[model samples]
Target: MNGDTAALPPHRPGSTPAGTTDTSHIVQGTPAFRRTAAALFLAGFSTFGLLYTVQPLLPEFSRHFGVSAANSALALSLSTGLLAVSMLIAGLLSDRIGRRRVMVAALLASSVLSLATAMVDDWSTLLVLRTLLGIALSGVPAVGMTYLAEEMDSRALGLAMGLYIGGNAIGGMSGRLIAGIVADHWGWRWGIGVVSLIAVASTLLLWVQLPPSRHFQSRRSGLRELPARWRSLFADPGLPLLFATAFVLMGVFVTLYNYLGYHLMAPPYGLSQTVVGLIFSVYLVGTFSSAWMGQQANRYGRSRVLGICYGLIALGIALLALPWLGCMAAGIALVTFGFFGGHSVASSWVGSRAGAMRADASALYLFAYYLGSSVAGVLGGVFYTHWDWLGVCGFVGVLTVAGAAVAWRLGRRTQPATGELALSR
Candidate 1:
């Protein structure tokens, strides 16, 4: 059972009144806002920490399981792929069952699955567990932003979203670092096991820290009505571009990292597995940029900041093509900064534009986001095999250019959308 204390009245399915948004919104720095932020921070941490713990272990998997580089990437790409698809259903379930229940269950269940994954010996069984873990992970990301948008004060939403994304950056970095270091010493199984244990602690923290949803009102859009919400989300003039942006950004980001480990491990640099993992600690840059640039977007304009971030991403990709390892590390740092910053702006922008359709819009963005990870991640290996790092950079550079184009066009026409709270207030 969800440990909620009934902070808000329970609205029955199909019983949301037209003016349901008239409820209170949690402003930043208040106790409720603090609790909400802390809860979501832990949620973001655990979800991504568990999801990406295996990334640094891909090389080990290839050695032990006797798989190709591309096949090894499937361990991660498959989870993200299934997560992309399952997010839609999970969002709908949250709309019916309540955000707390879906997210809490997602955290606990996925944590357990991650632990179980460490015990599996067979590659096929490992793949199966990862796949299920993806499905189990769906409920949180699908619903967390929606919950924030629905409950947080409109003026403070951007910063709250930024902090959430910041948690993701740290969690992702810690998982990769810890796993890589531990795997180098103890083996991949123990690496994964350690991450799973951290996830368990994070889950418990989330259960206790996240206060019940104070502004949530149930909207039971049954399975039959799901298409209409999808239609509504796609019909928004700007949302489609934002979805494409998610696709481009995530594709370029994942593709760069997917092969970089191999490149570093094999190159003139000849870094150890532990040092290679330490490079991922550059994600600390992302942790800063996501929060800082989010507030910048809020203060200036999301589109304006987003367009600049796209340019930064391209610039970063270009730098990676250089011969020196120092250049490559710097490039990765820039790319991490840009990717997380742009993600923060775009994600919060989607939530702001979604109105009552926040969950559906978020799901669509994530669907495209992880879909890019799955598709481009594997495809990048082909580029690496044929043309080397230059080929990978060129491919991602093209995607980054496309993203910049979308952002430029989007910034030209769309204004910041004031949320439902503004109308109700």
Candidate 2:
């Protein structure tokens, strides 16, 4: 289930009224399209930028909190862990309320929490605020995907999704880079404060510019109706494997990044924090790869394209195990490129396969995705402490191999023996 499987879901007969006006689809080259795309881009930026603001500050956290690398990682891990669980509920909540309202409130509330996080002196209090930020963020990502799937023209949907993900890549990069550099000059709190202020602007753009949802009709289904839809989503042939891919992919990526700062800061490469921050600019490659690879998947098949990406991820991990700085940078860039490309393809695949349950499918994928980040990210620190970079690489390597195996199985199931071809809508 790939390629033209990216097509939109058909309208339910009794649900949408006659003469409701077919102005729902915001196709390319229209004013509504421009506004909606820009608004979502800002939404993507705010959500990720706020969430990852503390990533590069991990070492500083260890120093200040007097904690081990594993303990310091809790700042990000706990947030992601909570965010993953909240996503399950947030999607269903959006079904009851409207998409636009949930997204706007999520952004605004999360931004405020981020700002508050900068001021807390108590370590426990800081963690509490970070946890809340995760719950607040749950409203945006899954709902945003559902909103785009509902409102955008089928032909232009791929590009719309790519742009939003590109925004995520840039936001993640900028947050890490800016925080590291600023922290080196001033303090970690100041670094976090700056990123929060930027997120405030991003929130305003999403609130003011996003066109209200014309396509979303409120679903009155309560908690009782969720189990049936959950069963349907899991039973789909393509979706379960895709969710596993999400978990493994994020696990590998976050594990490497979570500990790389520590490795680069110690003995052989005692790089300054600012320089360390500059290295995360590798995310620019991801910004380009996601859009480009998504286009390739549209022409070729997602299954064929995705396996190659998994191979690239493994190759990158191998490079990181080497002892050269240049080699490490190259490895990180490769990993970033492959990660964004595979994520773009796989995430779009979930929407394609879900039919009408776009929000639930997206929520499931993100839930696994963030869960991997929380679990594997913290585990990486333990490996680093015991056996250094080799152990860390070994852990990530195993996950990548498993991801490749799953990708191969998915490809075989989705493609015919005659030739690889796009799935019909």
Candidate 3:
């Protein structure tokens, strides 16, 4: 058996070859493939939906809790910060246990926590629940990517990852829209409660539909091996750049949305919470862009498509700087498009490049990804507090430009000659 065969699960009666290089992988147009896709889609949906539900309510939290805008953002920042730290451990845990088991437990626990968050009256208690929610959510994203990398056909990986991320887009939009609209009629707590209930439904669907992993090979090494695994990933020229791209892309995207509601609610715009939430409906554009651009990456090149996405993001930021609301709306749509597309390309690239280290590489990538969300997101609030919207814009602009530079550098790197470890260059 070759390296590819060795990486796959032990063959049983009637099993196909393992790994994306052969027909054994879950390919498109098959029932198994469809089930896996649907399962992962729900995973992305529930995880992101639960993570971002508190975002649109930041302003509402400020009013109810009698805190500042920056302080209110802790509800999100705390979750993401803890999430970033927890994913490193979660990845290793899944290696010891099983991917599906970890993800299922995570979804159930997080949904329960979100429901509890809806009932909390104290600000500190709410923050505590959100923090634990982050730890619960850590099981999904990294492990899901590793699952796709292990089980899906390599040729179809981009599209599969895109669909999963498309689910994330819809979840994010729906969560914000639901929370904002319901909060208008009832209260922020009601908005959260409704979202929590929806998450429970999604969790049940995922539990029933997702097939057991057929290609997974459990690792015996524990945290003692983590440092070496991470070092190998960073030593790769392209992987580190891809990780950096994840950081900036997520940070800039979160920062823009974090304060957008506050900006529209104040002064000349003075839009209601419902109207501000409606603005997030723009995330629908992300659903399309992620799949479309993922296909584009498969056809053209991952790096090339990623650079275009960064350019679009920078241009959107420029449009947002204008005082006109129409321009700002268009800018939001463009930013949404760019962000989802860039994320799809970057994440798929990491999977394709990581080879045997898929789990560790994905975990580290997301660690940076959410770390950016935690750090830059809160920092953007500081900019808003000081120089208002322009300050926020400037801060995000710098991050975008820096991310674009990294994408450019990665595009110039040469693909490795080894077939099993080759990247789309």
TM-score, each model? Answer: 0.94, 0.93, 0.94
lDDT of 2 at 23: 48
Q: Which candidate leads the pack in TM-score?
A: 3
- lDDT per residue, candidate 3, 249-347, as tens digits? 999999999999999999998999999989989999999999999999877888889999999999999999999999999998999999999999999
Model 2 segments beyond 4 Å from truth?
1-23, 415-421
Please state the error at residue 397 of candidate 2 in Å.
0.7
**Model 3 poorest 10 in a row by lDDT:** 1-10
Ranking under lDDT, best-scoring first?
3, 1, 2
Q: Where is model 1 poorest over a 10-residue stretch in terms of lDDT?
A: 416-425
Q: Which stretches of candidate 1 lie over 4 Å from their true place?
A: 1-23, 419-425
Which residue runs of candidate 3 sit more than 4 Å off their true CA positions?
1-23, 414-417, 420-423
Candidate 1 lands at a TM-score of 0.94
Residue 13 of model 1 has an lDDT of: 27
Residues 100-205, model 1: lDDT tens digits? 8889899999999999999988999999999999999999996888888877777778889998999899899999999999988998998999999999998888
